[model samples]
Target: MTILIALLSGLVFGVAFGFLLEKSRVFEPGVVVAQMQLRNFILIKVWFSAIVTILIVVTLLRELGIVTLHPKPVLLIGDLVGGLLIGTGMTLAGGCPAMIMAQIGAGYRDAWFVVLGGLAGLAAYLTLELLLRPLPADGPGPLTLAGLSGTPFPALAVAVGVGLFACVIALERLRPWRLDLGAQADGIHHDRPGSPRRP
Candidate 1:
């Protein structure tokens, strides 16, 4: 019963997350590619906003004893390699895993190929897991900023969340998101003649 409840809760949150992503239109291929090229700020804005929100929620849950925090042991080499691979794939596909799902929901025909490619990558990783085992060991044990800094988790969470939220606001002020969307409000490039192109 507990497992079922947890599954249902996860399902609800997943739907809500997808709905928010769709409403923000950050899952659009143009926006994703623009972000990869550093041509826009919408993707970062959404990411920082989500990070702040999750930090606050998780902190509150921990304080109320509703959830426990578990930091994973650091595996520097594996993390670096995995991040590089995923980043490269995202740049090529113009969408990350979550965004790909949202893209499919938004009627993008190309997202199917991204999904297949991800599956192929997963298979490759599984096959290489044994050979990569030696490089996976990196750190002594689990670590967290709070533990390293000798601060309470709640305090650290609040400080980090507030700082990120401020950054989100600043980003919005610097680049009004509408400008990132072409004049037609679509993701495609539609620069006008004599208009200055942003670097």
Candidate 2:
């Protein structure tokens, strides 16, 4: 009933959000590159805004009994390693694994290889985990951001918001936004967004 409604709502919202991301020029190569270059601000703004809103909303929900904050202990070694790998791959590939998905749906054929590679990587990892057991990291739980810091939820949320706000302001000063020019009119960027550089 309510759970089903909420799940449906989340799916609907995600689809709507993907469509909006496509429309907003947020998923462009120039945008990602600028973020890497420390030039673009919109991507920073959106992500920061999302984090801020989620932290505040989740904290409130937990307080109201609408949500629970059940978190497992953090494993910094694995997290740091995973982040480094994901970041390095994203930097080299010009697209994060998640964005690779959006690219695929938008008709970019090159994304097929990336997706395949990702599948292979996952399969390899699973095979290794089955053999090694605790060789890498063992986890039987979920981790939340607030759990790692041990700060009050409201304070953590505020801290995150302030930090993200600072980042947004800093990136905005770089003026990374580019005009669409005639690209939209031609329906080229409208399909496989950002720039034509990404595969």
Please report the candidate that would top lDDT against the real structure.
1
Report model 2's TM-score to 2 decimal places: 0.71
Quantify all predictions' global Cα lDDT against the true fold.
Answer: 0.84, 0.65
User: What residue pairs are clashing in model 1?
Assistant: none
lDDT of 2 by residue, 23-138 (tens): 65555544555557654455666677678788778978987889866675455556667789887777555577656666666776876887788889899988887665553465
Model 1 over residues 63-179: C-alpha lDDT tens digits? Answer: 999999889987788778879988888888978888899889888888999999889988998998898888978666788999899998888888898888888888889888878
Q: What is the lDDT of residue 73 in candidate 2?
A: 49
